[model samples]
Every structure is written in structure tokens, then in C-alpha cells.
Target: MDPGANWWEALSAIGTVLAVLVSVAVAIREVARARAAESALEDERRQRLAEQRRGIAALVTAWAESQYEPSPDGTHYVRRVIAHVANESTEPAFNLNVVLAYGSPLIQLGPLSIPVPIHVLPARQARSWDVSPGFAAHSTGVGQVPTDPIASISFEDSRGVAWTRGYDGKLQEGGGHQAISPDSETGEAQIGPLDSPFNPIAVVTAFHSALESATTVQDLKPLLSPTATGWSALTNEELVALRDEHAAYGLAAHVWYPTPRIAYVRLIHDDDIERARKGDSARALVVTLVFLVGKGWRVFSSGGAVTEPDWIKFPRKDLLRDLRG
Candidate 1:
């Protein structure tokens, strides 16, 4: 064979070997890339889980600090959290279940025999969640919304007392009334009382009566003497705004009265110092007062009314005489 031919053959073999080496190198690089991607995905998953645990821990701490205790079954507790969601959402956007679970430390949702699984779904906005009923034998008292825009949701037990979950995963009485009736002029209808020691139904009745006689703010002023603090605290601008708002709605108070028998008052009682410091301490007596002019019944005031007479200074002993007809 010619020496040039032999040299060409040797070069061809070397070229083939180089091509094989290059292919193997390319395969190894691809494998390494795939492994790296898998590792990154795992790291991300672990990070998400850690964040979730941290969130759960924070919620539990808040509940515990509020003095909430786990249920006898060791899995359930009641606490109040802001139900953050649009009024029209189909599902709750809060993760109350996880919060409850972590906060209660050992409470289980199953033994509670709730009909639906309490779920808190993520809201459209960050840092908010929707609350609602979850899987259990009965409704969890989380998702129900009131029909009226001004009305708030409340829960009632078989004994007719209203109930609500506190921030610490414990059940407590709610501040609002379950029902209100406004139409009866005789003040015999059932309604929740306002927060003051004064009866809400009575205030409403008096206000309604005074409003019927009032042609201006001056006329309305005397009727509101029972809730003088509420009125006095209002700025002139605020009163003007209120008047304008009422005028736009063609609203005016005529006669207001509370149902003497059905109105009940609730007092707040909790030993949690943090809750009180957080302004969570609240006592309310519910009374339904009907306003004749509005042809509606309102849950008078969640906060009770206080009497502040401008010119009269009567001792507590003579107060009854002064108010007596």
C-alpha cells in the first residue's frame, strides 16, 4: 500500500474516535443539567413547606396568646380571624383549618363531627383569606354571611344564646343579635339591645317618637339625649355628612322603641390580658329598636348608650326620680 493512503486511513480512524468522545461528553452534560433541575425543584418545595409551617406557627401563637384552649378531643378550638374576601365569593379564601389545627396544638377536625371541612382559601389580595364552613357533621359556623349590608353574621345555639369564635380558638358570645323586628309601634316586638346599659329598644322608640316631631336637626337633638356621647362625639362635618347621606336615601327617624321582653344584653368576660390590651375586650347588650319613620328595625347599637344631659346634674340616687314621669 502507498504510504499516503496509510496515513489517510490512520487520520480517518482518529477522526471517528474524536467524534465518539464528543458525543459522550455531550450526553454527560445533558444528564448533569437534568440532575441540577431536579435538585432545584426539591429545594423550592422544601422552602414552600417551611414557609407554610412558619405561618401556621404564627397563627397558633396568636391564638394561644389570646387564651384559647384546645377542645376536649384535643383537635378543635374556636377563635376569631378576619374573614377577608369579597362579599360575593363562592368559596372561603382563608385557611382557618390549618390555623385551627396548629393553634389548638392537638385538636383534630374529624372528632368534632363537623359536616364540612373548614377551609380558608387564599384571597385575591395577599395577606387575606376567606373563612367558611368545612367538612364536618354540621356547619362550622364560619362561612355564613348576612343578607343585609349593614348586618353582620352571627351564630346561635339551641338555647337561643348567640355564639361566636374568639381569636384564641374558643367559643364565646357574639356582640350582635340574631334577629330584629321594627314594625310594632307598641314596642312589643323582639329585638337586640344596644351596648349601653340603657335599653336599645327604648332608645329607638324614643328617638322615633322624637323624630316624628322633629322638622330639623334641633328637633332631632332632644330625642338623642339618651345617646348624648355618640352624638357629642360627632364632628359638625360628620353630622352634616350623616344628614346628607340620610337625605339622599330619603331616610328620617320617626319613633324608636325597644321590645321590652326580648331584648337581651351581653357582657364581655375574658381574663386574657393581651386580648384586653389589643382592645378585644367588648361587652354588648343587644336590643331591637324599631324606627317608625324608616319602617325598619335595626339592632340598635352594639355599644350601649349613655345619657348626658346638658344642664341637669342629678345624683345617682335622684336619677330615677328625674327620669320618672
Candidate 2:
């Protein structure tokens, strides 16, 4: 073959390879552009979904407020913390729960968590629930500083999707579990009185009725522990007098269980402890009932007089310390 003919053929082959390379480069660019578009569309879809989820959860909101006010029973003034929940949307919120908590690094008498369940909250309305029962009234000896509490709320939207708004007020889906009624002092879970004999109020009521008929020290001894100071101090004559007094007064008892095993009771004529705070002219009987493992409930400590408003101690330091653990 001639040299020029060979050179022309070589040049044609190089042009063919260049054309193929260009075609491949164009294809790769087009594929990359398509993938980029798909990725962007996916990101936008996710963003929309997130916004929709947040909108559904944000319909309801909750906050906490604390104030010094009359207790629920109208006995005395207490520093009370209440949770306020509002459904701002036109639709009703279901399974609404408000929780006021002191999270982590427990403060004095803290690591406190109070949960109140409101089965349903009506549309465009608000509701309030007591998170703490007269903080000063219940927590008598506990340090009262750092009383500010954070609140979290959980509720179900109209679509039956569960959501939680945390302390930061950020909305998230799928709350772990609902909090039912909780103990006031210990924040332990308790269903209402189930008619069991172990119910604290029932046991105290029965004990009160039994004490009213006791005629002698021997009769009273069974009602109170031998180690109780009140038991040691009561004379036979005093016991008879007390029985007669109980018969005449028929005092009502307000019981608080600091722990399952311990009860602090306020024996009052009515809900009014104000009468008792007035220099013993009319005073309330403050007693402690301890549940002995096999023996049931007995008056562990008695004859404590609440002659002053500050003197009424329900959740004492020792009990709170025990609760902290």
C-alpha cells in the first residue's frame, strides 16, 4: 500500500474512536443529570412529609404554671404546680397527657415526674391539671428553691397517630407509652382504689373506726405500734377520753402515702386546717401510719399537733430522701 493511503486509514480510525468517546461522555453526563434530579425530588418529598408530620403534632401544646393557692380540699395555701394543655386546632386531640418533670441531676427533693392523663381535649379549648399538690404543703421540709419545672405533652391526632412534644417543644411521632394516674408524692404508678384491703385510705378508715371503741390502753395498744411515742405516752384514762372524743367529733382523715409502706394522715374536723393553726384552740391531729410487713397498718407516730400552718408536715425530709433513692 502507498504511505499516504495508510496514514489516511489511521487518521479515520482515530476519528472513529474520538466520536465513540464523545458519545460516552454525553451519555454519562445525561445519566448523572437524571440521578441528580431524582435525588433532589426525593429530598423535596421528605421535606414535605416532615412538614406535614410537624403540622399534625403542633396542633396541641402544653406548658406548666406554679402558684400559691388554696389546695384542692380547701384546707390551706400551697405552692401548686399545674399543667395547662391547649388544642389550638379545630380538631379534638385524643389521649392527651401532660407531664411536669425535673429531669436528671436531681435537685433537692427532685427527679420529680408528675403525669396527668386527659382522655380527650376538645377543639380550640384548654384544660389544666394539677401536677403537684401544694408543693409547700406536701413537701414541708424539702428545699423549695429551683421549683421551676419543665413539661412534656403527648397526644393523638385525628388520624390516630400518636405524637409527643418534648420539653424543647419539638414534635415527634410515636410516644413510647401513655402515663396513667400517678402517686402525688412518689410519682409511682397506681390505679385508683381497687377495693383491695391493702388500700391505704380504707385501712386508715377502718383503724379510725376501731380506735373509737377502745376502752383501755390494752385496747389501744393493738391499734398503735409499741415503739410509737404516742402509744408510750397515752394513759388508760387518756385513751378512754380519746375514744369518747372521737365518738363526739367523728373527725375526717386526709391521708397521703409518701411511700407504699408509710402514710401521713391529717385528722381534721373538716377540710379546714385553718382552725388547727390557731394556737391549739382548735388543732388537727397529725399522725404517721406505718404498714408492718405482716401486721398491716398501725399508727406509727401520733399526737403531733398542727398548731401552725408551717407545722403541718406530710412529706418530711427523711421520707423525701428515701424517695430520692
Candidate 3:
């Protein structure tokens, strides 16, 4: 009856089908495992790159001189920028280049085309380059590169991997990226953001401005904290008087944030230069202000007090401590 032949043939056919199915299932599992492994590798690469980026903390600062230079265009207040940079990093940076940026309200445009000379800085070392800002020639109004200017800088690690950072001059990290072009001569590689801080002179300038420009109590209100632990901003009358007296001000060297919300802005009364000498006249005073969250910078200290902590007594020592080498 050929029974044995049929039964054996059917069994053989079934075994072959089972073998092919098993092969396909195993191949599918292998493909999935490969994809999972590749995804893990990509994640690990990202982590390693982040660690590399953390090695470099390049900072640029805007240090305004006490004496304000008169710009040919009297409408603008121009000041010299002692653009300083330091490598607070673990590695050496070479072929380092710094460029001053110009734009209104950061994140709008990119960096300016003007490039400062390149230099080399090692870890923990700092170097200074001078730039005069607010000049209509170099910077364009809207207050010549807002108060917060981008000091776009780039450098290659000892290994030649290029990195770029856009320092907003206030120590806040702006745009930064890796895998930048290594060629310094080309016009292709440039700083990230071209935005500027509206007030370049920092809080003290802002304070002096509020004082100089305030004509009435209503005009002076925005610059002061009417209800604070230390209501120390200039009295409405004081602000009006300063404007009338042409009260010149020498911004204090340091703007310290005693607390995140509270900032201490110190200034020397230069209305009478000689009288403002260390012990002469009022000498110096501080205004403690509160930083209104998401609104703006520190609210003017309430009292309009003319005295500061022990720090202000020694201007040379406390001035520009944040930018110190």
C-alpha cells in the first residue's frame, strides 16, 4: 500500500518546514539584537562627547574703564572693552581666536565679522585683549551691541578637535558647538550668536542712567524697590538732583550677587572727581537691589544708602574679582 513511503515522506516534509521556520525566527531575533546594540553604542558616544565638552570653560568679559571716552558721535556713549578670556579648563587651547559680536537682544542674529587676534591660552591661565565698544564704527546702535555682547571664541584642544563657544560677557554660556572648521584663515567659521546686552556698562551704568535720566518721581519709580528690606535706591528727589547736577558716576569695579535675587551695585560719585577720592566727599556707595524673576535685573536697593560693606572700602582689591586671574 506504500503506507510507509507516504508516512515517511510526509514526516520529512514537516521536518523541513519546521527547520526553515526556525531559521527565519532566529534571523529575526538576531536583527533586533543588532539594532539594540547599535542604539546603545550611539548613546554611549553622546555621553562621551558631553564629557569632552565639559573640559573646556572659555570665558570672555567686558570690563569698562572708569573714564568714559567721548565718541565723535555724541549721541552714543562709547567705552573701551578690555576683552579678557581665561581657560578655566583641564586642557590647553590653541589657535584661540576671539571676536566681538553685535546684535540686539541675543538669539536674534549671529556674531559680527570682526575678528580679534588669535592667541594661545593654557588651563588656568588668562589673557587680555582690548576693544573699544559703542563706537559707531565698530558697533551699531541699538546702543552699540547691547549691554550683553557676545564674545565668540573658538579653539582647538591639544588634539586639534575644534570647539566654539559664544560667551555673553556676563559668564552665561551662550551658543557652543563642536566639529567646527579648524581653518582660522577662512571666513566660514565664526562665533555662534551675534546678540548684545542692551546695557554694556552693567547694573551700575543702569543705575547711573536711572539717576541721570529721571526727571520726576514717576520717571524714577522703575529703577527702585519701594518696598524692600533695604529700600536703597536713590530717592526720587536724589535722582532728579543728580540729573540737574550733572552727577558723573564711576561705576564700581564689582557687581556682586549676595543672593541670586539680590545684587549689590557699587559706584563712586564722580560728580566731583577729586571729592570722590577714597575718603573725600561721599567716596563710594552701594545700592542693594532685588532681581525680579523673569522681569529684569536687580530692583534698586531701597534706601539710597551711601555706604557699602567692607568690600567697597578697598576698590582695587574687590574690583573685577570675577575676572581676576
Candidate 4:
């Protein structure tokens, strides 16, 4: 055999092997590029879906209106908070429920903070519901003072996607159905609780009886929880003011329970009837009694149109004068 012919065969074999290596490299690069494109498309799809979900929730809005008024039973004063929800989008919202939650430090009595479900909210229309019948103010012994009246709301958009609108008005996906209770009745959302361990009405009556019999502020100390806001370190001036208040109001005329753990005692004054006859029906003091888990029921707070001292920002003397009136 010729040596040059053998050399030619060797060169051809090298060329075939090089071509196979280049083909394999090209195929690998193509596969990597295809995978990167597919990943980018998947990310875009998820982002678009998220934006659509957020947009649907953003179209729903909620606000609240509140005022001090007599409770439904005409027994005691209560701060009635009405929640107004509106669906601005053309699509109706479904399973629209509102959960009135206390942030912290404020004790929720019974199931008062349960979800208030509104089956459906029509598009471009607004509806209002009283959400604060069993709500309590700042606990004299517990957490931060209650400020914002509005609570967190949840709903489902037309596409059946769950969404939550927080108290801060930010809309987010999921958490919409977390507030719904399995035991809720099939009809309208109820305002009051069905069961509790203690009777708040009887507790309030007993508290008032003890309050009326006390001859001095020191004697009244036992009627309050030891953890009450200023009850432990009450100044001499504060004691005198409380004594005068007790002397003027005497005892509660009527009592009502906003929850199984809270009672509102109506302390009608001497001239309250005359004031009411004159159309000034907001003159009496409403003492709040809260049931503590280990300590039972005690006076937690009090307020009136004239002597709402915590909210009035008035001097002590002026507050006492208004209390007497």
C-alpha cells in the first residue's frame, strides 16, 4: 500500500471526528437557549397573573362611620361603628366578608370579632353594616388604646379569586376565606354571640351595687381590677374626683351586655330626664365593666357626653364640673 494514501485516510477520519464534536456543541447551546426563553416566559406569566389579581382587589374599597348612641335595647350608650363597602369595578364581588379585629392589647369578648359575611356585593354599589355592637374600647388594664375604627375586610372577585383588603387599605391575594367560621348560620351575619361562660348583665348589676355602697374612693378600690390604667397609683385628686362622681351618679338604672365579657351600665343623673325631655339625650355616664379571666368582672372604663374625660382633653376641674352637670 502507498504511504500517501494511508495519510489521506487518517486526515479524513480526523475531519469526521471534528465535525461530530462541533455538531454536539451546537446542539447543547441550542438546548440551553430554549430553556432560558421558556423560563422567561413562565416568569412573565406569573407576574401578569399577580398584577391582575391585585387589580381586581384594588377596585374594592371600604371605610367606616362611627358615633355614640343608645344601644338597640335602649339601655346604655354604645359607639356604633358602621362599615361601608363599595365595589367600584363593573364585576360583582362574591363571598364578601368583613372581620372586625382589635389590633392588640384590646380584649375581644366572646365571638364578637367574628367574620361578618355578606354573600354578594353588586358592582358599582355601596352597602353599610353596623360592625361595632359588641366592640370594646381601650381596656384600662390591657393593650394599646383603640384608635382606628375600621377592621380588615376580605372578598372574592368575579373570577372566584380570593383577596384580602387590610385595615390599611392594601389589597393582597389569599387570606380572604380565613375569617369565615364553619358554624356561621346560612343566612345573614349575626352581631351578637351565642354562648359564653358568664352572664355580663348580672355581673354589671353586682358591680354597681358594690359601687353604690362604697362611702369613699378607697372603699371603691375593690370594685376595680388591680391592673386598671390608673387604679393602682391613683392620686389624691383623682380619688376625690371619683368620689364626687360616685356621689352624683349613685347607681346604674339600666344595664346591657354588648358581649358576654362586656357590660354597659347606664348611670342616669338627677336632671337627665329633664335634659332628655328637652331633646338632649346624651347627658348620662355609661360605666364599662369588663370580665377578666381570673379576676371576674370589674369597672374597666367610663364615658359620657359631658364627662368623657379620656377623650375630652379638659382639665380635671372642668371635667368634674361637667360630670356634675
Off by over 4 Å in 4: 67-81, 89-91, 101-116, 122-124, 130-148, 158-160, 178-325
TM-score of 3: 0.34
TM-score of each: 0.28, 0.40, 0.34, 0.43
Instruction: Flag clash pairs in model 4.
Output: 105-143
- The model with the greater TM-score, 1 or 4, is 4
Candidate 3, backbone clash total: 16
Compared with the true structure, what per-residue lDDT tens digits does model 2 show for residues 169-221?
A: 88888893434222244433121132433344445555567777766666656
By summed lDDT, which 10 consecutive residues of candidate 4 come out lowest?
186-195
Q: Higher TM-score: candidate 2 or 4?
A: 4
Ranking by lDDT, best first? 2, 4, 3, 1
**Taking the tens digit of each residue's C-alpha lDDT, what string does model 4 give over 1-325?**
9999999999999999999999999999998999898999999999997787677678887666667776445666656656677888878888876654343332222223233467888888887654453443222223645454555677888888888887667877887653332233421112122222233334444555565555455666665655455565666676666546755653332234443344566566765655533435545777776555544456766556222223322223322221112
Cα deviation at 85, candidate 4, in Å, is 1.5
